[model samples]
Target: MTSTTLRGVTIDYDDLGPPAGLPVLLVHGHPFDRTLWAPQARALTGAGHRVVTPDLRGYGRSGVTPGKVLLADFADDLAALLDHLGIERAVVGGVSMGGQIAMEFQLRHPRRVRALVLSDTSAAAETDEGKRFRNRLADRLLAEGMDGYAYEVVDKMLADYNVTAMPDVAARVLEMMCATDPRGAAAALRGRAERPDYREVLAAVEAPVLIAVGADDAYTPVAEAEAIHRLVPHATLAVIEKAGHLPGAEQPERFNAALLEFLAAQV
Candidate 1:
């Protein structure tokens, strides 16, 4: 893992694959780190595409601070990361909250994103009730820390198929969840609850889009993916079966099949 300072925040990221290869930036979701894309990164890098995975603002290997943050703050952080690497444009991909950030990145820095991969995520604005629920989650984390919360939500964060058939993936998910900084996790959750409606942004994104979802994903189900597919022009959709919210980890083979095929068609 490598660390760099951007806007006074210490950002930790992993830069792998050929230096001159087509750039591919992978962003991790809330309560997870760049490790979330471990499997996919290896495949992408081995396939000759530069893979850069970053620990989002308040997540793993990065700073741990509690403050008000918006989705744009996270998006801008990525733009800054790419600039630090001297990358003008790259294929941007993210899972869950990371996916939302990718969409936000397209909106904020259009020329910086050559393509998009939105995985197990949604583009809708956080509803009023959703905001309150997320705030309460933050409150719980600050009050009790991540132990119980991590275990309790592990099943939901992962799919049923993952819990039963992918024990190794489940363990890793639990490990990352347990290691989450309460303040950082809380801040991220709160920040995510304030993310903007990207439906309009999705429709406007000129880059080709790929929307991938775990068939069993409960948080951002197939319906959500379909809705996003309808909005994103030139977008492709793939629903990986026998996986859940974290399909990239739960079913890497299938996930990578769709991803690599997509990349091969691009630069």
Candidate 2:
């Protein structure tokens, strides 16, 4: 793990694999940390790709900001990280909120993107109801802390089978959520509520794209992935069976296989 100051915050990230290998930056979703991509990091590193996974501003060991944090803020932090590492370009990817951040990054720094990997994310703007809900959740988190919210959404975060059968994965997910700072998480929620629509952003992408999702994801289902695929006609879509929101963790082998194949053929 390495720490660097970017945009007035300390960002914590892991730099794995050989220095000369192709760089792959993987971003974790809301309420989760870089550990969410541990399996993928190992697999990609073994396949001779450099994998950089960062605990976005408030999630893991990184510094936290108490108020709202725009997706642009997160995107800029990633750009700064690449600059810090002297990386001119990379295959940038993310899951859920991270995926949105990846899109924002591509929008802001198109030349720095080699390819895209968007997993279980949407390209649409936040609905009015969603904004209200997110604001309410943010208030709840700031008032109550993470325990209740963590336990409440843990099951929803992964497939029911994962919660029941994959105890270790379930525990890790829960632990990451429970340990997150409420102030940071709340700030993120508020920021995410104001996110811009990215449908046009998706249509403008020129890089090779890989869109993967869990077949059973309730939050961002297969249809959402299909929508993204349609926007980027050249994208390769991979739907992992028996997984939910976090397929990369619920079904790491399958997720890693899809990712490795995409990197080999596309980027």
Candidate 3:
């Protein structure tokens, strides 16, 4: 892992594979670090692609901000990271909140995105109830820390079957969440509550898109993925079975296969 200062914050990241290989940037979701993409990173790098995974601000080894951190802020950090690495463009991908960040990146830096991969995420703006819930959750996190919340959501993050069948993945997911700084998590939640609707932004995308979601994902179900597909008519959609929100980690083989095929034929 390497560390760099972008936008006055220290960002920790891993740049793997040959420097000349086609670049693929994968972002992790809320409360998780770059390790969420560990399996995918290894697979992509082995397939001769340069994989970049970063621990977003307040997650993993990255610096934390006490206040809110907007999706646009996250997108700018990524753009700055790419500029620092001297990369002109890359296949930008993310999971859940990371997927939303990817959308923000596409909206802000269209020329720097070669293609897009959005997994288990939505483009709709937060509703009034959602805003209230997010703010309340943020307050809860700040007040109580992450243990209880992490434990409660672990099963939802992965399918209940995954907790029993793939203990290692379950443990990793929980660890990432439990270890996250509450201030950062709260800040992210607060910012996410104010995110704009991206339906039209997605509809205007000229770059190739790949939408992958777990069939059992309760957080962002296959219906949400279908909605994204509808917006981006030319996108390739893959629904991984026996997986939930974090399908790339829960069902790495299937997820990697879909990703590899997309990169080979589309990007």
List the candidates' TM-scores in order: 0.98, 0.99, 0.99
Least accurate 10 contiguous residues by lDDT in model 3: 258-267
lDDT (Cα, tens digit) per residue for candidate 1, span 70-93 = 778888989999999999999999
What residue runs in model 2 are displaced by over 4 Å at the alpha carbon?
none
- Could you give candidate 3's per-residue lDDT for residues 27-128 as a string of tens digits? 999999999999999999998999999999989999999889999999999999999999999999999999999999999999999999999999999999
Cα RMSD (Å) between model 2 and the true structure? 0.7
Q: How accurate is candidate 1 locally (lDDT)?
A: 0.90
Candidate 2 Cα lDDT to native: 0.95
What ranking emerges by lDDT with the best candidate at the front?
Answer: 3, 2, 1
Question: Which stretches of candidate 1 lie above 4 Å from their native place?
Answer: none
What value does the lDDT take at residue 94 in candidate 2?
99
Put down candidate 2 lDDT per residue, 1-267, tens digits, no spaces. 999999899999999999999999999998999999999999999999999999999899999999999999999999999999999999999999999999999999999999999999999999999999999999999999999999998777998778989999999999999999998999999999999999898898889999999999989999999989999956999999999999999999999999999999754
Question: What C-alpha lDDT do the candidate models reach, one value each?
Answer: 0.90, 0.95, 0.95
In the order shown, what is each candidate's alpha-carbon RMSD?
Answer: 0.9, 0.7, 0.7
